[model samples]
Structure formats: C-alpha cells, structure tokens
Target chain A: MIEFKDVSKRFGHTVALDNFDITFAKGKITGLFGPNGSGKSTSMKMIAGLNRPDKGEVTLGGLQPQESKISIAYLPEIDYFYPWMTIKQAAGFLQAFYADWDEAKYKDLLGFLRLEEGMKIAKISKGQRAKAKLLLTVSRRAPYLLMDEPLSGIDVLTREEIINTLIRDYREGEQTIIFSTHEIAEIESLVDDVVFIEAGQVKLAGSAEDLRINKGMSLLEIMKEEFRNAN
Target chain B: MPTSRLGMFSKLYSKEMRELAPEMITVIGLAVLAYIYLFFKTHDYPFAVIGPVFMIGGMAAFLPVISSFKLLSREWKNNTVYLMMSLPVKGGMIMGAKLTALLSEYVLGTLIAGVSGFLLIYALNPELGQVLTSSIPGIGMKLIELWPQGLALYLTSIVIIAYIASISFFSQMVGKLVSRFSGLVTAVVFIATAYLSGKVGDLFWLNIDKQWFTNGINTFDLNVINQFLIINLLFSLALAAVIFTLAVIIYNRKIEL
Candidate 1:
C-alpha cells in the first residue's frame, strides 16, 4: 500500500498540498481526480519520489519512495524521453536500467499501440509520443504504477487506445495503478476506486460504483457537483 | 534482458559519450584544419607554428571544462531530468558516468593535440625535436631517465581536469535548486569553489615544499619532483571525490523538477 500521512507541500505562496492524507489500496486502479492546481499531480510525484513533502511522510509498503523506486514505474505528464532517440534505442537504453523490463511485452505493446520501432521521439506526433510513454512504462512489471495525467492533451482516439491498453495490461492481483487526471469520464469504467480532491484535500472518496449509485450521477457529474457545492 | 550494475553503468557512460560526440568531432575537425594550415606555413617560417601549436594544446585542455558546464544543465533544458532522476540508481552512478565521459573527452583531445604537436615540430625542425626528445646533457640524464617525470606530469594533468569537471557538476547541481538567476548562481558557485579549492591545495603544496628539496640540497632531484607530482595528483583526486559526493547528495535529496 502507498500512504501519504499529513503531507503538505508548497511552492512560494501557492499551496500545492495542504496537510493532505490519503492511502491508495494495493492491486486496485485508483483515480485521483481534481481540477487544475488541485494537487493531483503533486500527489503522484510524491509517490514516485520525484517530489518531497515539506511535512509528514510518504511511503510505499513501509519503505520511503526513494528506497523502493525499483518497485515503482512512473510516467509523468510531459514528454521526458531524449529527442535524439528512436523508440527502439530508447527501449534499449531503459532496458539496462530496469530489471523488470519485459522485452516481449514491449514488442507487443509497440505493435498494439501502432508505434514504429524506428520512430524518432522528436519527430513523432504528440499522440504517438503518449503511446510510446505508456509502452515504456507498462513494459515494466512494477508493483506500483503512478501515471500523472496520462490522457491530458491527447486526442480522443489516442486516449481510447491508452485506456484500452491499461485495461489489457492491468495485472489484477499483482499491480496497483494510481492515475491522476481531469478526464474522469474517460477512465470511468476502468477505475475500481475514486478519490475526488479539491484545494489539496480529499473532497469525496469511495468505490466508483458506490459513488455513482449514491449520487445517482456519473463520476464526471459528481466531481462538478462537489466542486460547485464547495465554492 | 537483466542488466547488472556494471552493464547499466556502461550503458549510461555510452549515452553520455554519444551526447558529447558532436562537440568532440567539431574540435577535432578544427584542430585538423589548423594543423594542415601550419604544414603549408612551415616552409615560409619554420618556427611560426610554435604559437599555434601551443594554442591548439591549450584549446584541447580547455574544451572539456566548457563541456562540463553544460553536462548537467542541459538535462533540465531538454526536460530529460525527469527521465534521469526517476532512474533507480544512486546519485554517484549518474554523476560518475558523466564525469568519466568528460574525462575521456579530455584524454582524447589532449592526445590528439600533444601527439600532433610533437610530430609537426619533429618534421618541420628536427634539431629542436632532438633537443626536446633528448635529456639535458649537463644533468647526464638520458631520454629514458626522464620517462617517469613525463608520465607523472601527464597523469597530474588528467587529475586536474577531473577535479575541474567535478566542480562543474557540483555547481550546476546547486544552481538547479533555485527558481531564478540559476545560471548566475552556477557561475558564482563555480568560481567560489575553484578559488577555495586552490587555496586549500596551496596548503598541501606548502607542506610538500618543505620536503621538496631533500637533505638541504639545492640541486633538482628527479625523485622529489616525481613525489611532488604524485602527491599533487592524489590530493586533486581526493578533493574531486569529495565535491562529487556532495553533488550526489544534493541531487538525491534536494533536486525536484
């Protein structure tokens, strides 16, 4: 399980996460839904060991994120691969760093995502690059996968492909995925649990189905209702 | 494929070397042009090439320091710091690979400049070449006798370059911890570090100076010179290691992007 205990992080005068506390259950796809500046990305970064909390702690299975990085696979929202690398070359480079990098899985995902091995990262379309990022990330059989805004700025068709890939690759009892995004409706069916956050605090949290039934609204509509009521 | 620690390090080192190849190639190309120009000018003024030859040698020594300034900063510029920081390796491995690659560049650059200079001087002015290659007659030392001193000097130069590269790494890592005027901070940190290390190095040299002229003899002893050079080399290497370790700590604990 990944735990964030009373964690608070700030940038200058902006409060990114204010005494935020949450726990993402193991082996479940947890949706971290929030609007802009709601600290969704910050939460993911904390779990990935990319950001440090100013107060309190973040741990993965009793170990700090830095100590357990080998068990976590992180895919940031921005493009992070080297521009000079072709997809194949990037994979080759990354394979050396990750012991869990599955070449067969990578090859299968490359074809499924329709990404060419020879495609230069700099030359590829944004949607294609998104797919490439997903391919590299999912190729590793990490216990925890933290993907921040995986669907943002991607076209609808590309987003559908990504969602489909996640559904296909999720190792039900063995993997935990924490997805942070504003596109709640897109992954609505895939999410087992949901946490709606506003101003860096959990506004609503429950099983996806339970939340829908209790509110008699879609996950997207529930988020709008909650934010509107808060305002 | 499962990657061992050494295997991963080799891959990282190769990546750094590849990123630096363009600059290395450009320097080599310019040096070649300079050498070719000197070859033709040799007939007009035999000793005219001396200045340009030394200038090339200086450039070879200076290029890696320039390269070192960019090695870490460019990762942020390219947004590749995300990929770099997320890797499950210690801070030492990442910076170590980069340091090794920069040192390799220094070695290759200096060798090309040094060897080419010797060949050009030997071909254009054989008498000067003989004087340089042969030992001092008054000292009664042969060329073979001076080999250890030459080797010590070469190794010391390598250590000095490595130390500069480590400082560059340390300063750049410090610069990245801020939001504004990062480049200026890097420049200040670099200058401050270099100045402080030079002062510290002087203290060690002072102690060496006492034993430098052994047994109250004013004559130059090759053994003492070699000993001094080795101590200098080890001192610089130790300092570089210390600075490099500090940079790694900052990288692992403080840096966020």
Candidate 2:
C-alpha cells in the first residue's frame, strides 16, 4: 500500500500538490485522472521519490519512497531511456541494477510488445517507445508500480496493445499499479478505483464502480464534472 | 553496506566509461586528423610538425568544462533525471561516478595528446634521431632523470582538472534550481569558484615567504620542493572536498527534476 499524508509541493509560485492526503489500496489498479497540470505527475513523482513534498510525507509499505525505491517500479511520462541503447543492451543494463528484474518476463514481454531486440531506442516510433517503457516497468515484479501518461502519445491501436499487455502481464494478486492519464476511457475498464484531481487538490476519489453507480456517469464524465465543479 | 556500495559504483563507473568512449574517440580522432593535415601542409619547413602537434596537446585542456557540463545537463534536459533519481542508488554514488568518469576522461585526453606530441617530435627530427642513435643509453638516462618534474606535472594537471570540473558540476546543479538565467548563474558560479580557489591558494602559500628561495642554500633543495608540493596538494584537496560536497548537497536536496 502507498500513503500520502498531507503532502504538499510547490515550484516557485505554483503549487503542484496542496496538502494532499490519500492512500492507495494494495494489489489493485488505481486510475489518477486529471487534465494538464493537475498534479497527476507531481503526485506520481512524489511517490516515486523524484519529487519531495514540502509539507508532508509519501510512503510505500511503511517506508519512504526513496527508502523503498528498490521495491517500486516507476514509468515516467517522458521518454527517458538512452537513445543509443538497443533493446537487448537496455535489458542488460537494467539487470545489473535491479535484483528483482525478471529475465524470463522481460523476454516474454519483448515478444508480446513485438519489439525487436536489436532496434535502437531512438529509431523506434513514439508508440513503440511507450510500449518499451511499459515493458521495462512491468517486467519488474515490483510491489508498487506508478505509471504516468502511459498512453499519452500513442495511437488507438497502440493504446489497445498497451492495455492488453498490461492486463495480461500484471499479477494483480501480488502487485499494485497506479496509472495516470487524461484519456480515462482507455483505462476505465481496467481501474478498480479512480481519483479526480484539479488545481492541486483531490476533488473526488473512491471505488470506481461505487462512484459510477452513485453519480450515474462514467469515470470520464465524472472527471469532467468534477473539474467543472472545482473551477 | 560498503560492499554493495562499491559494487554499485563499479557498475556505474563501467557504464560511464562505456558511454564516454565514442565521444572521446571523436575528439582524439579529429585532433589526429588535424595533426596529419597540418603536417602535410607544413612538413616541408623546419621543425614544423612540432607546431601542429603542440596545438593538439593544448586544445584538450579546455574540454573538461564542456564535458562536465554536458554530463550533468543531459539528465535534466532529456527528463532522464526521473529514471536517475528513482534508481535505488544514493545521490552520492551517482554524482561521484560522474565526477570520476569526467576526471578520467580529462586525464586520459592529456596523456594521449602529450604522448602523441612527444612521439611525433622524437620520430621526426634528423638531429634528434642521430643523437638518439649515437647515445641511446645516455638519452635513456636523461629521460629517467626527468621523472620528478614529470610526476609533478601529472599531479598538478589532475588537481587542476578536478578543480575546474567540480565548479562546472556545481554550476550545472545550480542551473536546475533557478527559473531563468541559468547559463548566467552557471557562469557566475564558475567565476566565483575560480576566484575563491585562487584566493585560498594565495592565502595558504603566501606565508611561505621568498626567504626560502633567497636563502644561501641550494634553490632546488628537497625541503623546498616538498614544501611547494605539499601546500599546493593540500589546498587542491581541500577545495575539491568543499565543491564536491556542495555539488552533492544540491544534487540530493535542491534539484527537482
């Protein structure tokens, strides 16, 4: 489980996360939905130990994010891999650093993602790169997985590819995944819970099905409604 | 804890060296090509190869600043800092590995350029060739006698490179903090660091008055040489520790990206 207790962060005059408090359930898929600059990335980064909170704390399984990084796998919103690295070389590089890295799963995901092992990261299309990032992140059997905008720049076909691979590869009984994206419809079917954030605050969060039933709207509609209400 | 730490650093070091090789090759390759071109253009004149080779030796000293900046900047510029900061590694290990890598590159570049120039000179001139042929043992002994000065030069070069790179590393770290004028801030950091290093050097060694040199004793006494080496070395090491600590603190605490 991951917990944020009154966590707040700011960049100059702009507040990224405002005294935010939330706890994600263990072994479930949670969807963080927000528009641009709604603190989705900031919240994710704080949990991944890339961004420190100014006011409070973010913890994973009773440990701080930085202290538990080895047990957490983070898929950032940007293309962060070295451009010169081929798929095989990248796998080797990760293998050296992560004791939990699964070689068998990595090889299987390479086939599932249809990424050639010899292809340089720079040469791949953006959608393929997204898949590559997902491949690397999910291959680690981490207790917590934080993914930001995994489907942001991909096409519908690639989005489906990612969605299918994530569902097929995820061991839900043992692992928890929190993924954020503006296109909620793409992941609406997969998420067990939903969080709607606006202006650096959480406006709505609960079981996805419960919220859907109570509000008589889909997660996407609820997100739009919540953002409108917050504004 | 220390064992795993060392293991982690070893992996980081090898990765850095691997990434650094092709770039190093490009610089040295260009220098080699230029040396050849200049030689072809000027070989007809007396002692002309020496001029071009000497230029190669001097051109690489300025690269540590640029290399250090690039090594630190790419993480933020490419958004790779996310992956970097998220790793289960210490900020100290990451920064230390980078510093060590850049330092090695600087030292290796100097060695290559210096040796290339020396070999070019030794292989080119007929008078030198004849002297070497006639008195090989004498030439070898003379070269052996140059060891003290050579060692001093090597140590001095390493310290100087470390000092410049530490400032460059800190400037890049500070660049991530400011909203604008990062380049200007980096320049200011560079200038301030250099000025401080000079002042520290002056303060510590000015106490060693010229009376040592003016004494009736021989000018190149072992004590005098040892005093100069010891003072310069201590100063260099002290500044290196300060700048490196500041860089690491900024890396661990201040950098957001």
Candidate 3:
C-alpha cells in the first residue's frame, strides 16, 4: 500500500506536486491518469524515492518511500538498460543486486517479449527496450511496482502484449501496482482504481466502478467533463 | 538469504568492469599498436618497449576519471537518474562499485602493459643481462636491479592517480548537487582549494628538520626520508578515502532529476 499525505514538490518556483493526497490499496492496478506535465510521473517518482517531496511524506507499507525502496520495483518512462549491455547481461547484472530477482521469470518474460538474449540493448528497437525494462522490473518480485509511462511509445498491439503480460504474470493478490500514463483508454479495462491528477493536484480519485456509478458516465467522459468544467 | 559483503562488492565491481570493457580494450589495443610501431621505427628497444607501458599506464590512470565524468553527467542528460535513485542500494555502494571497477581496469591494463613491455624488451635486446649489470651502482643496486622496482613505482603512481580520480569523482558529484552552474563552480573550487591548501602547508614548513616533523616534534632521531614516504602515502590514501566518502554521501542523498 502507498499513501501520499499533503505531498508538495517544487522545482524552483514551479510546483510539480501541490498538496496532493491519495492512498493506493494493495492487490489492485491503480492507473495514474494525467496529461503531459500533469505531475503523474512526478508522483510516481516520489513513490519510488527517485525524488523527494518538498513537504509532507510519501509512504509505502508504513515506511518512507526511500526506506521501502527494496520492497518496490520501479520502471521509468525511458529505457534504463545500459546501452552496451546485452539482454542477458543486463538481467544478470540486475539479478546480482536484487535478492528476490527470479531468473526463470526473467527468462520467461524475455521469451514472451520476443527479445533476443545476446542482442545489445542499444541495438534493439525502442519498443523492445521498453519491454526489456518492464521485464527487468517485474522479475524483481517486489511487493509494489511503480511504472511510469510504460506504454507510451509502443504500438497498440505491443501495448496490449505488455498489458496482458503485466496482468497475467505480475499481478497477484496483495501486490500493489501503480502505473502513470496519458493513455487512459488503453488501460481502462485493466485498472481497478483511478487517480486523475491535474495541475499537480489530485482532482479526482476512487474506485472505477464507484466513479462510473456516481457520475453516470464512463471514466473518460467524467475526466473530460471534470477538466472542461474546471476551465 | 544474506550475502557476504565481499561477494556483493565483487559482483557489483565485476558488473561495472564488464560494462567498461569495450572502452578499456580499445585504449589498450591502441597503445599496443603504437608501441609496436615505435619499436620497429627507432630500433631503441628499451624506449619502444617502455613506450607502451607508459602510454597504457597513463591511459589506465586517466580513463576512469574521464569515464566517470561522462557516467555521472549522462544520468542527468538521459533522465535515468530517477530510476537509479529509486533502487534499494545505497549511493555509496554505487560509487564504490564504479571506483572499484575503475581501479581494477587500471590495474589490469597496467599489468598487461608491464608484461608486454618486458617481453618486447627481452626479445629485441638479448643483452638484457648486460643492461641490468651495467645500470647498477653497487651490490644493493645489483640486488634490486630489474624492471620490478620500476613497475612498483608505476603502481605507486597509480595510487596517486587514483587519489586524483577520487577527487574528480567527488567534484562531479558535488557539481550535480549544486545545479548546472555548479559543475564550473566545482572545478574552480577544487583548483582554488588545492592551491590554497598546498600553499598554506608549505608556508608552515619549509623543510624545517624533516626528522622532527616525521617524529612528531619529539623523536628527532628517526630518518626523515623514510618517514616522508610513509606520511605521503598515508595522506594520499586518507584524502582519497575522505573524498570518496563525501561523494558517497552526496550520491545517497541525491535527488534524481
């Protein structure tokens, strides 16, 4: 589980997160929906302990994000593999550090992702690299997973492959997953909960079913109406 | 399961070494080629043989410093710092792995150069025995004559180089800490600090009884020259350790862009 309590982050005079408060329960896929620069990635980074909040706290499983880092796996928006490292080498390198890393899972994921073992990450296509990054993170078997823009640059088919792989392989009871992206429709069916962030603040959040029932419309329509009405 | 500290360190260090292998190989290969070319051209076998050693050692010594600059800077440029900072490992561990790998590469490269140089010299000049005997001043010199001492001295130079490398790594990390302009500031600060520290230390003692200084002002009977080497070694290692530690702390607390 993760909780952000009055978390505010600022870069110079620009606020990246503004008094944002939200809680993500365990065993569910929570979609962090926002446009570019909506602080979705920033929030996920804070949760991953990549960036510290200027005020308040971001806690995972009752500990500060940084302290709980070992228990959480993070996949950043961009590809993270060292350019010169082959797929197998990168996996081996990561496996050496992460105690819970599952080698079989990584191999299986690689097979599913259709990535060659000996191919250097730099030489691979961008989508393949993204898949490799995902494979690396998911194979860690961390209790919480934070994925920032994992499906951003991939084709629709590849996105579906990724979503299915994530759902089928990593998703399990009592394991929390928070993913940030602007492509809400792509993940609409997979997400159990939704947090709509705008202007560094959480404007809407709750169970997807609850939101749909109360608003009498699909989540996307509600989101569009909310932004339009705010403006 | 708990892992041994040495095992973890070795694993991390090895990973870094592998990542840097391409660059290391290219540099060493170039040095070898240059050495061979000079060996045939000058017909001064010793100089040609020694040429590669010096070139390789110099490259080995400086490559880490240069590589580290790019490595640290790339994190910011590529936006991978966010993911790196989020990992569970301590920043010090990350830095230690990098430094360890750098030193390992330097050591391995130097050894290769030393061995190759010796072989080349021996092959080109069959009068290696005469050269050794002629260079010695006396029995002591004869006892210690050969390339071994030179090799040892070269290794010592690497230690000095390593200290400088640590300073560079620390400066780069600090530069990352302060902002974009802080990189320039860090370079300036390092030069200014080094200048001031050296000047101040010299001002306090201008060769005033090296023995007295070596023996802590009381035991003046101790040999100053021997003590000086020990003191210098200790100072260099200490300075390296401190800089490395500071870099680790900054890296640990660093906020990824």
Candidate No. with top TM-score? 1
Candidate 2 residue spans exceeding 4 A from truth: B1-7, B38-44, B126-143, B213-218
Model 3 misplacement above 4 A: A170-172, B1-7, B44-57, B78-83, B118-140, B143-155, B196-224
Ranking by lDDT: 1, 2, 3
Worst 10 residues of 2 chain B by lDDT: B135-144
* DockQ, cand. 2: 0.50
Question: In candidate 3, what are the lDDT values of residues A110-227, reduced to their tens digit?
Answer: 8888888998988988778888888888887888988899999798888988998888875567679998988878788888899999999999999998998998998788888888
Provide DockQ values for all models, in the order shown: 0.78, 0.50, 0.52
Write model 2 residue lDDT over B46-65, tens digit each, in one string.
38787777677766666665
Give candidate 1's fnat, 2 decimals.
0.77
**lDDT score, candidate 1:** 0.89
Q: Higher DockQ: candidate 2 or 3?
A: 3
TM-score (chain B) of candidate 3: 0.76
lDDT of 3 by residue, B109-143 (tens): 76776667666677677677576666444334453
Give lDDT: candidate 1, residue B96: 90
Docking class of 1: medium
- Residue B3's lDDT within candidate 1 is 76
User: Roughly what TM-score does model 2 have, to 2 decimal places?
Assistant: 0.92
DockQ score for candidate 1: 0.78
TM-scores across all candidates?
0.96, 0.92, 0.88
